[model samples]
Target: MDFEKIVSDHKCRSCIISVERYQDGGFGNIRVVAANKAHREDSERVFNHPFVPDSPYTDSLPQDKNFEDFMYRCACLGQPLHTYVHVEHMGLWVNMFLLPLESDKENIGYCLYSCDISPYADSEQQASLSAETATHVLEISIKLQGAKKDDIRQVFRDIIEDIRKICGAEHCCILYHDITNRKYINFCEAMNPQSPLQPDAIYNNEKFYDIANSFDSAIRGSSCLIIKDEHDLAWLESVDPDLYSLLLENGVKSGILFPLKHNDQILGYLWALNYNVEETVKIKETLELSTFLIASEIANYQLMKQLEILSSIDILTGCKNRNCMNNYVDDVISGKAELPEPYAVVFADLNGLKRVNDEKGHSVGDSILRTAAAILSQVFYDCDVYRAGGDEFMLIIKDGDVDETSIKSKIGQLKEKSAIDTDVNFAAGYYIANKGEDIRTAMRLADEKMYIDKKEYYAKHPELKYR
Candidate 1:
C-alpha cells in the first residue's frame, strides 16, 4: 500500500502528523502529511502554519514530563496508542491517536492524528464557568453603558481588578492613547497587593511611541501577543531600549497585550503581566469575549463626550456658546454654583462688524469674530469667555483683583494689532460686583456701560458706523 496516497485519500476532521523511524532507533522529525480542509485551516490559524505534506510539524506540544513519557511509551511498545493531550503553545486540548505502520514484518513509521477536544473537556464545569464569566462581563458592559462621564474611570478600575483576578495575573492595566495630546494615559490599573509591581505608574516617553509602533507592526492582524521570556524582550529592546528596560524594571517576566479596537481603529491596549502559561491561555480566551464589549463601551463614552462638547461650543469663534452661558446662569440661580467673592463681568461687542460683513463679505466678518474672540481669550485668560450673541462676547471673572486700567491697555493693544491687519476694533465695558451684589444686576450694568463705549467708538471713527 502507498502510505502517503492512502493518508491523502483518508478524509477526517483530524490533523494528521507522520513520523518515520530513523536508523538511530529514534523517530525522524514529525511532519504534517495530511488533514481535511476544515482541520487544515484551523491548524494554520491556531498553529500559524499550514499542514502540507512533508512539512515539518511546527506546532509546539505540551511541555510536561507526562506527555514526554506517554510518547516514549507509544514508540517503544510497537502497539497502537490513543490518549488526550494538550498543545501548550496553541492552548488547545486534543484527542490524539497513533497507529504504527509496518513493512516486511518491521515497524517503519507511525501516523499521529489529533482532533481538537477543548470544548468538550469537563463540559459541564466549563459551561458553568463560562456562564459565570459571561454574566460578570455583561454586568460590566451594562455599568459602562449607563455610566456617567465622571464615573467612567472608576468603572475601568473595576474592570482591571476583575481581569487581574480572572487571569491570575500579578498586574493588569489599560493604556489609553490620547492622540491629540500625544501621550499614553494609564486609564486604569490593578495589582496583586503583595506583587512587587506598582499599579499606579505612568509611561510617558518618546521611546514608548517607538515601541508601540514596532509592536503594532508586528501584530498587525493578530488578535493578541504573548511575551514569555527575554527572547521576546530582545525584539522590544531592538526597537526601544527605554521601554524594554521599563518593563523589566516592573518585574514583567511574562505578559500579554491586546488592542482595544473600535471601528477598525485602535483606541488603546489592555495588558496583563506575570501570568503563567495556563493562566495566560485562560485569560486570552476570556478576553476574547470581554474586549469587544469594553471597546464598544469606550467608543460610546467618547462619542457622548464629543457630542456634549459640540453642543456647548461656538463653531465660528471657538468660545463657549450662549447655551453654555444659559446653563451657567441656571446653575448660579439654583444655588448649585459658587463664585469667588469680588467677581466682575465684562461685556464686549465687535465694532464695525456690519461694515466688514457688507464690504468684505461674511467670510471676513467671521474671521474678524474669531480673531476678536482669540484676543479676548488671551487678555482674560483666567475668565470664562462666552459668545453671548452675534458680534458680542461676555467674560465672567470668577477670581482675581480687577486691574481696570491694565485690562483697558491690553484691549487697546489688541485694537492696534487688529488695525494693522484685520482692521477690527472692540467696544468694551466692565462692572465689578461686591460680595453681596446680585451677579445679574452687575451684568445689566455692564451691558448698559458697553453701549456707552460703543457710541464713543463710533464717534471717534465715523467711517465704521453701522448703516
Candidate 2:
C-alpha cells in the first residue's frame, strides 16, 4: 500500500498507523508507518523535531493506553471510529477519527489516524456523537438539569438505572468523593434483580478510600478503564491486588469505569459491572458523553450544599446560626414541623463575653464564644442547639430523651466544663412544656429564668455586677 500517498491526499494532519497482528488474535507494538506534510509540521511544532515515519507512536506522542486501544480497535479489528475526548491531564481536547485500510502484508494491519487538537473544547465536536448517543446524553442532561440538591439522590438512582440498562450490566453505581473532608459518598446504585452479586457496604468502610484511590495507577491516564477478561484482571491485580480481590469477590468479571470529572477536577467515579463486553466502544462513547453532564450536575449539587452549610453555620462558634434557628422556628409555627407531647426549651447566655471583649480583645472573645458553644454542644449533644444571636444559645430537647432534672444537671456540667477554656460561666434556664404549649411562650419563660440566674451570679460576686 502507498501509505504516504494515502496521507498526502488529505489537507489535515493525517497518518497511517501499522499494527502487528498475531495468529493467536492478539496485537503487538503499533508504529506510525507514514505521515503527510501537514501531520509532519504539526508534530515538528509540538516536539521541536522532524516527524520520523515508521517509528513507535510514542516517539511523537505520549504513550497513552487509550490512544493505543483506539488504534488497535480500528486497524486490527477493522472498525471505523471517531472520538472527541478531553485529555485532561495534558490540558488538550482531542478530536480524532480512525478507519481500517487494506494491508499488503498478512502480519501487518493498517489504519488511517487523523486528528485535530485544541486547547479549548469545541462545542460542535462535543455534540457530534452518534444519533443514539446524542439522544440518550441529551435525556440525561434534561434529568439532571431539573434536579435539586435535596432530590439529587433519587435522580441519580434513576440515571444510574438507565445507564445500567444501556450497558447491559448486572450492577451500576456512582460514588462521589468529598475530597475536602476525605470521605466517600455513594450517590446512587442500581443492581439487576437476577445479578449474582450481593449488596455490599464496602464504600462505608474507612479503608475503602485508599483502595479506590489505587485505581489511579491502573487507569494510567486513560479516559476510562475497560476490563474485559482474565488478562485485564491479571493486569489489575498487578497494579492493585486489594482492588482485584474485591472485584472478584463482587463478581465483577467484566466492567467499564468512567471518572466523573468537571473542569479538570475529578468529582467521583461511575462503574458498570458484568457489562456487555461486545459493546465496549459503544459503552465508552455513551459514558464519555454522559458522565460529562453528570459531573456538571454533581458539581452544582455540591456547590449548593456547601453554600447552605456556610450560610447556616456561625463561623465564630461553629454552631447553627440565627437564620437556621429562625427557619426551624417558622417551620414549627407554620405546622410544617411537629413537636412531641412533652419537650423542654432551654436558654444559655454567656456570662462574661462583654468583659472578655472589652479587656482582652474581640479575638479572645471569639475564642471564649467557641469554648462556650463547645460546652453547650457537649451537654446537649442529643438536642437541637442553635446560636440565638450574640452569646445566647437555645436548645429544644425532647422529654423522652431527658427529664427536667437531667436538663438542670447537664446545665451545671456545662458551667463546670466551661472552666476548661478560661474562667467562663453560663447563666442557663429550662422550661418543660406539655402538648399544645407554644414554643414562643416557652422561649420567653426560659429567657426570663435565664435573667434571674444571671442576677444571682452577679449577687454572689458583687464586683461582676455588670454581667
lDDT of each: 0.68, 0.84
All candidates: CA RMSD (Å): 8.1, 2.5
* Candidate 2 clashes between residue pairs 3 or more apart in a chain or in different chains: none
Backbone Cα, N, C clashes tallied per candidate: 0, 0
Candidate 2 local lDDT, 329-403, one digit each (tens): 899999988887688899999887788788889888888788888888888888767999988999999745557
Residue lDDT tens for model 1, 329-378: 78876788987567788898888888888888999889888888888887
Question: Which segments of candidate 1 are over 4 A away from where they belong?
Answer: 1-13, 17-34, 37-54, 57-129, 199-202, 228-243, 276-278, 335-337, 403-406, 416-422, 461-464
**Can you give the lDDT of residue 8 in candidate 1?**
51
Top candidate on lDDT is 2
Q: What is the clash tally of candidate 1? A: 0
Total clashing pairs in model 2: 0
